[model samples]
Target: MAQKKIGSVHDLQTILQISQALTAERDLDRLLWLIISACSRLVDADRSSLFIVDQSRDELWTKVAEQTTTIRLPMGSGIAGTVAKEGQTLNIVDAYQDQRFNPIVDHKSGYRTKSVLCMPLINSSGEVVGVIETINKKNGKAFTARDEQLLGALCSHAAIALDNARLLRQDLAHQSLLHELELAHSIQQGLLPQSAPSISGWTFAIYQSPCEQTGGDYHDFIPHAHCQAVDVVVGDVSGHGVSAALLMSTARAFLRALDQDSTRPGQLLEQINHLLVQDMADDRFMTMVVCRLDESGHVRYASAGHEPPIVFRTENGYCDENVETDLLLGMLDGVGYAEYVLPPLNRGDLLVLCTDGVFEAVSPHTGEVWGMERLRELVRKQASVGASALCQKIMESISDYTDHSPQKDDITLLIAEKT
Candidate 1:
């Protein structure tokens, strides 16, 4: 039966249906079939073949809708490839007559070649995902500009579908990865000391953020049975990855052992650093703040190149550095580390501890870190605020400053207040 000619808007009711069906497809392979089928039907071509570019193979593979047989063509080796390489449409009135028309596909399929109207399949990034080739227009007539117009509209829909499929896959993969990360993050949070040690007349909070799905930041407050001392720790490893997260776990295990000892904070950190420096990978290092808080909250602390904790005084809107820190742990062997002291903090004063993610969160526009100065400002502003409120306020500030840019690094926060 001779097909009705697509000569008027009324005749285009089928084309409109084809467009809607193409857009409605979400499965990538099914969408490809719908596209090539619509192109062949609209143009009344004898065959419609899709050749998707395989970058790794440097070939165009026919992934769907084979009219005769499987078709694969070399890049820059045939009419289809040339159309793709040039990013243009080519109507070969006589495919055999063209020097670039490779006869290998026809030879393989045992089909006589006559004519081909081929167009490059482009995606949003403007890269060629594939090519569509329609062969032998109906009634032995040549394909026209109107046929090109119809095919062009179909190709536009096809491009959008292809891009949607690609992005959908990426999002699914990222989501799955985040779920795994969340699990590890939850387990690590479980390891953190819960509710701080209930020492009379003392208060503490831990703030932590992981730059990725998980992070290298660590913090804890351990109570003593015989002494007024309570162990505290804050540490950050050198980088971000599952490997870094593992290293942090090991560091935590080591700290737990040291916390069991009735020893000086300085000696404990040195022993841990000595053990870590001997075997940590070339790129690995950790910064830490270790302190012991007594019943009266007289905090004796030490550092290993970790950032200083900021203490906000209620006497006025002033934030002071509690102690100076040394270099990060695991960077070098036999590095010495030690503890220091801090005067007893009064009720209403707050202590803030963090990893580099705190100071390094950038203003999306300016690309500058939130920095130490601004951090102190937030602490002072929230001096009268509860520990949870202070933590929330700082986090909100970081998010606003970054302008919702995808978090570049893990974020961690810990707050200690005497009430």
Candidate 2:
């Protein structure tokens, strides 16, 4: 049976049904095919094709029409492309008479060309995203103004549906990635030390902050030989985030294992460096400081391309012991490290060790870094306070200096004081 003409009240009902179906579709391919089919029915056209604009390639492409398996044309090359490019609605009475009509499609498909109604599909931003082309009215008449109006309205609904589907997919992918990052953060936190170790004749305080969920900064305390002394280690991996966190964990394990065999800071770092060079990636490395303090306040320390530790004397004020350093760990195998034994600390003396994140923190407004000079002044001011209080004060000072700027790296601080 022949189909009824589309100008009746029944046609309006059919259009409503098509709109509902198009809005409900979440799959892009199905939605596009529905748009082409629905518009063809609404205008009583023999065939229709939907061409999506590929902005990256500057082309128009489609795979949803009969007699066209897949087609791609440069923008403004054919009737459909011209409508997409100009953001216009074209109603042609005779396709063969129009120079814009390409006869190659008719020749390939063995279908005669007659009339066409081509309209641009515009998104909410008023930008053309695609084109809809209807070919050959079923009654052998050219497409009328009424047909153009109906198809244009349906295209409006279709455009909204396509944009919604794209946004929905992007949101889902973003949510999934966030969940995975959070999980990695939890695992990295679990790898860190739970509490500071108790050492005779000394009080220790520590603070760690990562710019992201996971970070590369690490610190640890290992007891030496029947708790006669404690070894403190602070390190910063080359980068931030999960990969850096993994490298930090590896360095931590290697240092701890090497500490079991040696109490000398230089030997321990040298052995750990040998292992890290074999295990770490070529571009990856770590800056680290290791210190061992005995019950008698004797301090032995070594540095591997890390910031020197600061010592605050109760009577002499602040002094940045700019100790000499070796090449950073993981840079080369069999590298030797040098250890410095500082004069035995007196009671009430405070030592501060930190990662670059503290001294190099950038101010939000001024872009100035909280450099070592400011850190020395802060340490001198807080030297008389308890180790825990001093740690908190330094963190507060850093926060004030940066003025809540987003952190750019991982920060780790360790404070050791003679009781």
Candidate 3:
């Protein structure tokens, strides 16, 4: 059927009203409903439907005009699909005579169909982005050329409105996600220790940097049942972001709760492993070092698949203590842990506990990792400095070696020196 140039003043006015109304609606579903309803009234049709093109799937999908349910059909499968595929206006006089018309919809709805005005919705880029189909003219006659022209104009406005609504929805979702991440970052920061512990006859310093807003690394200075000692814990969960932060929080709480029962590093770790194994996911685990330091300079510690602590002695220089590691926490239930008592610390000795992040930091310029050997050598050189100064120097060295490469993981360092 050919399009007629003739249109009434009323039809033009109606189209203008629909264009303004469609542009005002930002919600995609509501905008689609308004488009279909207005198009049906403009063409004096009994019903109408709007189908959006999904180029990736090569399909046309539409929500049922009167219901929340949706229906989909392959492109070029029916009258609407044909118009969309060819990017042409379809004015059918006899629906059943057209082989492209599918009667299954009519049979399912129990409504007899005689004429259809299907038009492709082309955007500014000349791409057919969707289709609009008006069904069964009310007068029981073949739809005229005047009806086709009116619907085509209306569909042009509808296409732009649909595209605007989709972009708005995407922007809103992105903003919502950013807000959530910001809130999570704030909470994760709050869980960390605010300041290093003030223990008499000892100096303490700590450095922690997370790769992202939230991370898996955790460190805590827990007071022991015996007022003479303090337990220092440093651990790393398996991953980053909110899940890992949550796991770190849980581990901190568990460790603090067990502090009242026992200060023995190995026993506390064994109990924590049992609790974590009961709830943690099978693929997730944590590596940690738990050390208890008393005022008398005695140090007892345990490791759960964590990095060994380097003890810098005034007389012997740097030595990596042979702390025996058990299975990583959350790996299995009923795992046993061993505790090692180091030779009592003398005056001017430093004990360093750190996560792998400190030693594994990658240098962007040289493409080299700040390996454990460099860390040991640096610790040996800085042994004479105060614990606080030593920690700052180590962090500065890493920063210079990496040449300001973005941190790739969570880096943590805890240094204790007998002054």
Q: Name the candidate that leads on lDDT.
A: 2
By lDDT, the better pick of 2 and 3 is 2
* TM accuracy, model 1: 0.62
The candidate scoring highest on TM-score is 3
Off-target runs (Cα >4 Å) in candidate 1 are: 1-20, 37-78, 93-116, 122-130, 134-157, 160-194, 206-216, 224-228, 238-284, 296-299, 308-324, 341-352, 356-419
Q: List the pairs of residues colliding in candidate 3.
A: none
Alpha carbon lDDT of each predicted model: 0.78, 0.87, 0.87
Better of 1 and 2 by TM-score: 2
For candidate 2, write residues 257-366 as lDDT tens digits.
78978858999888889889988899999999998889999888899999877888886775756667888999999899999878788899988899999999999888
RMSD of each: 6.5, 4.8, 3.6
Show model 2 residue runs off by greater than 4 Å.
1-8, 26-119, 130-150, 225-228, 256-263, 267-284, 332-334
Better of 2 and 3 by TM-score: 3
Poorest stretch of ten by lDDT in candidate 2: 1-10
Cα lDDT tens digits for candidate 3, 288-382: 99988888788888899998678888877766556577789999888888998888888999889898889988999778899988888888888
Candidate 3, residue 110: the lDDT equals 75
lDDT of model 3, residue 255: 88
